[model samples]
Target chain A: MTSTSSPSRKALSKIACNRLQKELVEWQVSPPAGFKHKVTDNLQRWVVEVVGAPGTLYASETYQLQVDFPEHYPMEAPQVIFLHPAPLHPHIYSNGHICLDILYDSWSPAMTVSSVCISILSMLSSSTVKQRPADNDRYVKNCRNGRSPKETRWWFHDDKV
Target chain B: MAAEEQEVRMEVEAVQAVYGDDCEIIHDFPPHLHVHITPRTADDSSQQFVEAILGILCDAQYPQKPPHVHIVDSKGLDENREKHLITTIENKAKELSSCLMLVALCEEAVELLSDMNHPEGNCPFCLYPLLVEDQSGTFAPFMKLMSCYHCFHSECIIRWWKWLQNEIIDSKQCDSTISTSAGNQREMEQQQQQNCPVCRKLFDAKDIEHILDYAGTNSSQPTDVIVEMDGDERKFLECESENNRRQQFESLLKLQQENSGLIEPRKEIVVVPGMYLPTTVMPTLAAIDAADEQHLDSGSTAPEAVDLNIPSNKATTSKHRDMNTRRKNRNHSSRRQPNVYPNRTQWIKKEAVSSDP
Candidate 1:
């Protein structure tokens, strides 16, 4: 599961810390449906449990998402990955990396953790097939050194989930 | 008919008063009026973002039949918005059928215009409402692209534009490193296509540059691109602390003057002949002298004499006479440090005697 693996060594900046705190408060007030934030002391890393939507192929299945914020977070996208025993999904790699554009090049500062969570949940809920990506084994081997998903140049060829 | 004519005349006068120069009478006989209506919001007027010129045609039957309202011209408003505006006004006129409703109709038009004043829909970049709907009523100010009429929050568009510029600059930097013909071709392609973030419409840099000032002022985020680009965080922190240190020094000086009569009561301090000191430096000298006297009374001579010599060396550079005064100051500084002061005093005394001849 690479439980001890950290995404980046850089510490969160003051602005990133402040914004994350705000997001934490908002999340506590009204968390996204099908998601539960695991309470932890660390502000830089968040582990959330996602319950697959009722109608999806992975319905009722539970998956863990690990979100690690970069130093220039909000400006930079958080590295979001599924924990080991990842769901069988075409866009998600076996190494837990997800090929989502918003978590990479499409990221905007205005998007918060809550918004990202919703986008991921929606991506999961709309999947028509339960299968790993074609090159998942090769990609996972390449990322054996614990590479962040943000470093991946994602090719978002499919608009459909 | 005469009474009806008077009522129409009064209504026309009322509309003129309400709309001022916006209300223009094309023909007086049948009361053909043109009223230019814009939203009441200050941004709408400054941007000229939305406005409608309504032409009202009144038949001879007049008040009995509601006046015909049609949109003559408008900017930044689509056909649907224009129709909705005229329809709302026409409905108001129908309700006020038998009475002189010209002024009321114009007011209603203004009210509706204001309601629909803002640029519609979300910012393309963030997909958030540009004008937020909430109790706080805070919304990011939006600007319309002059060429395409596509609107976006000032901050969003600016950020995207800056990001594009940075991408180009970065590519240019990479080109030099690569120095390949293929890289040059890619750079040329990037230069040729700086499309609108939303529409992919070709827009010149000037289109966004014109509103750069507005974007800068309207930005709510603390971290601006300029600050990030400069990356002078250490320099900014140093300057801040430097200011704090200066302020602390000034306050300490002020406190010392207040406690001890360190400074002469301004008017009474006659300037010493041939001694030129800035007013601020004078207080510092007086404070040092006062501290020196206190040290002498306490009989701690060695350290006090050393401290006094340091100031004397700094305060007087050209004159041997100032040196004599400083030796006197040092003598007064501490009685216990007689060995150090006596030697300096003897040297100054000899100098004074030699200069007197």
Candidate 2:
């Protein structure tokens, strides 16, 4: 979450590459529930398909998450946002930006792609009402230049879904 | 109840006595107790990897039923190990089902702990085995954060720790909200504390002090073999531990030395900085660098001459490779200040004045 407005995108460090490869293998062995990774030659960016849990309001609905890792990854949180046609949830903006703490300020190096997916799924599952954020339009306007969610100085006020 | 209330209270007291302060009585009637159990490390926490507070609950049935045992709190035990501890204790209770087996159950818990006192699984950071030997048939030393028994391969954790330090500094600089409000030194001191990569527990710099060298600081002047060959630095990386590489280098140096007439080590001394200062480079207990100089200059361990043949361990150390290398270097002697100068001067003078064969 080292957001300096510099659009930080660099190749993964050797350590980061090793960690991601290991994570991919681990994800294959035991992927988190309700998430599937679209494997490609690219190790830097991951496109994960998320299905809302069965018992939740967003159940049976599918959404794609575009996760972009910075050079440092885990040390720096990945840029996680939904693809076009993001799910309808209070915390998720219409422009596919999901406002979650873990994706930003609350990120810890301990978290892996699997854990982040689980958190996102839990966020989607816990949504009682399907609606975009109150200021989705304005936020989307600001981010219309294809800004990463990591660039936002996000204030994570809401915890309960 | 088969056993009287007074008898049950007495039994709980006995359990407390046996475990001393480790046993905590939550309630007296049914003997709901919490007992802290550790492996048989003889109170040496460094040797201990797991500890748990077992929550034991008993019903009004007294000795007619067994107590409910679960792990109330634990450190170093992962989810699987925690479940195993609980399951085994629960089974032990079942076996001692109808009897006053409070103390016996606690002992069983201890026995389980003693059996499972080792750190297992891959390092959280590297996703590599914590206790396994590598392709080189040597084990990469692993250690645990003292505060929380979260274990990691020394190099792996050190690598993460270094990365984290850089990230913190980068983020702090980027965070302009507090720009210049807090002095940089104070801010740095506050941020110097790092979280355990596995548990997120705050650990002191001291927690990793022992394993710092594993990142190849090579602080201590090793008497190990310095490889005579050059430019195959990639081979150095392949060696398991620095120890194995040192041995490999020593044997290679020996092969060259025994064929002393065939290969002159004095002419081809390859000084890998912060690496491979084979004290055994000298045939006798003479100044290692001076001996090399002896062949060329007939033993002049002058600081300049010796400096070329013997790159001080400090010169070769890669502080830049380690982000917080400068901080760790604080414990070391001055980087350029050669500690071997005095010894070399005397040794070189003896050989030089005595005149060569």
Please give the distance, in angstroms, between residue B320's alpha carbon in candidate 2 and its true position after superposition.
25
- Model 1: CAPRI class: incorrect
Q: In model 1, which runs have C-alpha deviations exceeding 4 angstroms?
A: A3-7, B1-113, B116-164, B175-204, B211-357
Per-candidate DockQ values are 0.05, 0.25
Which candidate number has the best DockQ?
2
Q: What does candidate 2's lDDT look like per residue over A67-89, in tens digits?
A: 87777665677878888788898
Candidate with top TM-score is 2
- Per-residue lDDT over B270-329 for candidate 1, one digit per residue giving the tens place of the 0 to 100 score: 322222211121223333443333223222213333234334444333433543344333
Clashing pairs for predicted structure model 2, backbone only? B273-B316, B274-B316, B294-B299
State the weakest 10-residue window (summed lDDT) of model 2 chain B.
Answer: B347-356
